[model samples]
Target: MKWTDINNIAIALMDLYPDINPQYVRFTDLYQWVIKLNEFDDEPKRSSEKILEAIQLAWIKDAD
Candidate 1:
């Protein structure tokens, strides 16, 4: 999955970290977790603050 795939990334995160609190996650932490996902194949440099924030927000919704 690429950085632009926010919904899929968020869903993966929700499943990977079921107990995580999205409200408490930092972007740096989120970035690391995302890159480590087995399905995540894009370069880290392709990501930006906007994408990260979008993923975080989506993950928050998924968590809810």
Candidate 2:
């Protein structure tokens, strides 16, 4: 997917899951994950999973 597409998806995800800190997720990472989601043909579910994973990792680091 294009950068703009990935960005839009990320923004939507942020709105849907406010508990996730958008700052901790880099645009490049989101783009890469978007590509993976497309490749796997599970874009929505995988994208949501990736966002949750990123949020979990960020929270873990914050606690450290």
Candidate 3:
């Protein structure tokens, strides 16, 4: 995945979890993770995992 893709994911994440700390998982981290995944030939899987994790985390927080 590219930086633009990760950035778009970050924006959606932020919208879903507005009260969460972006500092803990910023767009930069997502971009870097995508780059790292590219090295392992697991970019798509890793990206989907991260996005799902973000969504789950947001939902958990909302329930609390």
For each of the candidates, the C-alpha root-mean-square deviation to the true structure, in angstroms, is 0.6, 9.8, 10.0
TM-score to native of every candidate shown: 0.96, 0.29, 0.34
- Which regions in candidate 2 have their CA more than 4 angstroms from the true location? 1-4, 22-64
- Report how far off residue 52 is in candidate 3 (Å): 12
- Each model's number of backbone clashes? 0, 0, 0
Model 2 clashing residue pairs (backbone): none
The worst-scoring run of ten residues by lDDT in candidate 3 lies at 37-46
Residues 1-64, model 1: lDDT tens digits = 9998999999999999999998899999999999999999999999899999999999999888
The residue-by-residue lDDT of candidate 3 on 1-64, one tens digit each, is 3423444444555555567665466545544544454223434434554564564455345435
Tens-digit per-residue lDDT, 1-57, candidate 2: 433243444544554446756556664664454555432333443445555555445
Query: Model 2: what TM-score?
Result: 0.29
Cα misplacement distance, residue 50 of candidate 2 (Å): 12
By summed lDDT, the worst window of 10 consecutive residues in model 2 runs over: 37-46
